[model samples]
Structure formats: structure tokens, C-alpha cells
Target: MAGIYIHIPFCKQACHYCDFHFSTSLKYKDELLHALVKEIKLQKSYLDNETVETIYFGGGTPSVLEADAISLLINTITELHTVSSDAEITLEANPDDLDDAKVKALRRTDVNRFSIGIQSFFDEDLLWMNRAHRSRHAEASVKRVQDAGFENITADLIYGYPLLTDTKWKQNLDKIFELSIPHISSYSMTVEPQTALAAFINKKKQQPMNDQQSAEQFTVLMDAMADHGFDHYEISNFCKPGHYSKHNSNYWQGVKYLGIGPSAHSYNSEARQWNIANNAKYIQSIESGKLPAETETLTEENRLNEYIMTSIRTMWGLDLDKLNSIAKASASPLLIAAGQYFDSGWIKQQDNVLYLTPTGKLYADNIAAGLFF
Candidate 1:
């Protein structure tokens, strides 16, 4: 019913396109660990005693932590929460960090799923992204995890960058297929403001990201995934049947979850809160036994719009019945708003479930926004 997301706010190095809150230093790691524990204890009741079905370690790079550190956090959650016996525990890891020793060590922990950041299979592309791992590390780490007996795994790939030609993009997609990775989470490259990629584009040191290139690559990605028999469960994620990322699916389904660590966000049905992005400030506040987070109570409109945006992106589509439950008489107006999309052949309704046509998938965000309350 609920989940837990612990952000590991440290990375080995900064990637060119990354804007996530992380430091390249490990100096405050021990203190940060203690602070995370304190934050966990302090926020135990955030989920209202809901049984935790998933625990995800996402971040700057969760693999940077030793196995014992990972185990300690899991143990703490178990002590406070009635976690499901078969809960999905995922760790977002970097390829280079998943060497033989590291993978073996992680096997001792409760982490049953791996979300490896493989990004690209080409060394040139990897260098362009300033990723810490090499092409060799990218391929080998997946094998290492499989060899170590982990079945529920997913890998991330990035496309639409200037360095990734259509041919190279196909190769990257083919590589994941060849590896038999059951679940894949891919995204088009975006240059967020203030990141190195954005600065480079501003200075003309790097070409700006081309939206056309991204769109083409995304289309190609969807086709490839469908051809490979992977389910297009969500816009950015695909999986062999029944292999969806439980934690992320919970997120999209509006399940309540506690977010631990700096800059992590938490949500229950009523309100949402996020921890401060500064590690020092977060640690200071938590050490003082204060939760270093801001809270936002959800307005009916906010909740309605959020559901519309997330649910419409899935293959299951948005259910009109669920929409009306949030605010009575909401779906009738929504169907009226959707009349244009239906006329354009972009959406089709079946048994009150609004589904996006393949063409509509390209403009899903626009359609969702247009239908928002």
C-alpha cells in the first residue's frame, strides 16, 4: 500500500546533464548516515502504519555505499514498519560500482532489484555525458548482477543526445535486448537549466538538444520495445510482463510513501513534503530532532490534475470512475474536454477508461494538461 524512497545524496562525479542534489565528496557520509537514521525514526508515522510494499534506494548513486550501510538502513525500516515479505527493494547503481566484490556484497542485503544506470553502450557517448563508468563497465555490471542471481532488475539508458546517432541508438536498444534485461527505463536527454550541458549550449561549446532528434529516438524506442515483446507499461518504462518497477509504479498510482534523506519528496493522499536539498542543513535539522522538510496539502484541483497526468501516461489508461471519485461530476467535464482528442482520433474510451492512441502518446502531456481541472 505504501513505499519508502531513500535518496543517497552522493555521487562519484557530476555528470554533464545532472541537476540532482549530490556532492562528489564522502567526507560527511558517516554523519549523513546517522542523520538519515534519525530522520527515519522521526518520520515513521508518515505512512500511517501502512504496510510498506517497496523500499527504493535512489540517488546520486546508491552503489557508492558499502553493503553494511545499505543493510543497516533496511533493518531500521523493518524495525519500524511492517514491510511485506516480498517487498521490492531496489538500489540505483552505477556500472563501475558494481564490480564482483560490490555485487556479491549487495547480495547479502535485502535489495532484490537493481536499477543500473547504463546510459549508453558507446564509449564516445559515455565520455560526452562525462559518466564515471566506461562502456566495458556498463556491459559487465549487468552480467555480474545476473551471475550473482538477481532476477528482478532494470537498467536505464539515455538517448537523443547529439553523440547518439540513429544507428548508435539502435545499437544501445539492441544491447539491452541481447542482455535479456527484462525491464528497461529509458529517457531522452534534456538540458536542465544551470547544468553543465545547459552552460555548454549557452556558450556554444556544445550544441543544444534537438527536440526532433529526441522525438524520433523515442518513437524508435517504443517500436523496438513493442517488437521485443516488452510491455509499454508507462511512457518511459517497459518490462517483460509482470516485471514493472513496483516502487515507481506505486509512485505513478498515487500510493503514499515516505521519502528519506536530503531533497527527497514524500506523499500521502492528503499532502506532500520534501526534505531540504542541502546535506549540511538537513543533517543539522535532523540532529536537532526536527524534520527538515516542507509540506504541501493537496488541493482537490491539484490532486485531480496529478491523477490525470500520471494515469493517462500508463497503458492501463485513466479510469473515469477514479477521476469522479476525487471530485464528483469531474469526469463529465473531462470527457467534454477530451472530445477534441477523440475527434482527432488521439484517444478512445472503453468502459469508461480513457486510453491514448499511439499517436496521442506523443502529445500525452499536452492532452493531459488541456484536460486538467
Candidate 2:
């Protein structure tokens, strides 16, 4: 099954660490929505008539839009494409935008899942991240969504920032557990170049991220999640059994998906494409009856490397038989490269499947790169 992702490119305010494509102004909001619907229609055949298993509304903040606006897009998609009956329709929202009224409005739509960006429940951390939501808003949003009868909820948390002390980090984990949210997507603070965080660090206005702190916090997260009975299904994502993000899981498993919106990426096994990052350009291109995107056809080597990189990060690890089907020569070189890691007790092999050990997960990227063809 395939998936569809709609990127809402507007935000009420910019987070200091965010580098995603978005505009703070809603001047072209209506026009952008029209263009998004038009793009969905234009790219309807991208998935080759596969029934859409997931429809994700990700963005600068999808909840920034009115519920009717969201419903319009979903309606447009369902009409133009073949969607599954029980499709996992998820909307990524910021805590501040999810008041009771908004939750009630969303309940009328087909969105069964809500991925709230409650980065931190501490006012200090929230302010430090320049988030628009306060701690109260985060707590209230979770309760409101649950009370609204939406059980498939996931809350995002940020750790390893300068302001997040070890005690505070644990408190954040404990708070999520207390709330009993089924899924948790946690990320370490990284200073991307050209972001406000990076600029602040360059000017000495903010401290740079510490790798040691991030590693330590990640360890704490894993232990806590284990004790709490959450499955560390993928790096940076943990969920209770059966609550893994179907959209993201499809992506990691190499299932084809179409991404609609500025700076969004799409894959269909053979090629990958990404839309232009500029909102005006995207709108203009769509208005002119053209797609504002670039495409790259995946070579065998590219596909093999991608599979190795993505699958290695998941709990299932890499499937050797599948890799062999794609590229027969890849397995030997990969196993040879993985030898050092295996000897070091960082990786284990069983029944031709490779998985990362607990310690090896800390350096997952590096190990994956080493095994690349």
C-alpha cells in the first residue's frame, strides 16, 4: 500500500531550531490551499493506483489551518485517489493551536490520529525553543484530544538541548508516561546550519549542542521506554505495541508514497522527487499547470544503500534476502564491512538478518555508512 503526505507551509511563528519550509504570514493561505488541492489532483497517478493506507498532514503546523480547510484537502484526496477505508489520517499540530473548539472541529473530519508538537512541557524549555505554546497548553492539548475521544495520539518531545538538564529530561519522560500517551517521537536538538539556532550559536547567543549530552539522554530515553513497555520501533520513535506510525513505517520499509507541497519528498521505488522549497514558486508553478519539483531515478546501488540505511535503523533490521533480490553483489561487501562492528559487539546477525545492538544504535548512521556499497 502507498501513502500520501500533504505539507502545510504556514506557521503562526517560527521555532528557533526549525528549518522546514514555511511562511509565518497567512497572506497566501487560501491560494496555497487551492494550489495544494490542484497538486494532489495533478499527482494522483503517482502511486500507480495503490490504495492509500495513510494520509499525513505535516507542516510548519497543520493545525494552523481551520478544520474545514483540512477537510477540503482530505475530501479532494479521497475523491481523486483510491484510499483505504481505515486509512490512518494524521495531522501534525502544535499544542497551542489544539484548543477544545479546534479539537471538536477536527473530530468531524476523517483525521483519526493527531501528532502534537509538545516539544517540552517546561515553560523554560518551551521559551528556550521559542515555541508559541506554554507548558499548560501542552498539558491541556493532550487532555483535550483524549477527552475528544481521539486515542491514536503521538506527542513529540525534544531532548539534549542546553536548557534540558538530566532531571528535566526525566521529568519530561515521566510527564509523557503520566499522560499515558501511546506513542512518543523524541528528537535531540541539533543545530542545522542557517537555522536561528545555528546563527545564535555562531554569535554566542546560544550554546552549541553537546553530543555527549544527547547520547546520555538517548540512553535514558531507551531505558525509560523499556520500563514503560514502549517499543523502540525506530530511531527517534517509540510506541506501545501496535501503535507504530504507519505512514513513517511505510517510508522506512520502502513503500511508495506521494508527497504534496513545497519541500516535500516523494518516492515510487524507481525515482524520488521533491517539490521546490519556496511557497511562491510552488504556487506559481501549480497555477501555470506544471509541477515545481525535481526528480532523480534511483540506481541499483542507490536503492541498496537506501535500504541498508533505513532498515538498519528500524527494529526489524535489514532483510538479506530482499537485499540479495535487489543487488546480489551487495551482501558480501556489506557483511565484510559489518565484520568489524560484529566483532566489536555493536551488531548481531541471525538468520541472515542484521540488527544493531544497544550500544551500536548510538552510532547507527556511521555503521550504516560503512556498510554502504
Q: Can you write out model 2's per-residue Cα lDDT over 1-373, one digit (the tens) per residue? A: 9999999999988899999999999988999999999999999899999999999999989999999999999999999888999999999999889988999999999999999999998998888888999999999999999999999999999999999999999999999999989999999898888899999999999988999999999999999999999999998999999999999999999999999999999999999999999999999999999999999999999999999999999999998888877767557778889999999998999898999998999999999999999
Count clashing pairs, candidate 2: 0
Q: Which sections of candidate 1 miss by over 4 Å?
A: none
- Compared with the true structure, what per-residue lDDT tens digits does model 1 show for residues 46-139? 9999999999999989899999999999999999999999999999999999999999999999999999999999999989999999999989
TM accuracy, model 2 = 0.99
What are the clash counts of all predictions, listed in order?
A: 0, 0
- What value does the lDDT take at residue 143 in candidate 1? 95
TM-score per candidate, chains pooled: 0.99, 0.99
Task: Please list the C-alpha lDDT of all candidates, in the order they appear.
Answer: 0.93, 0.94
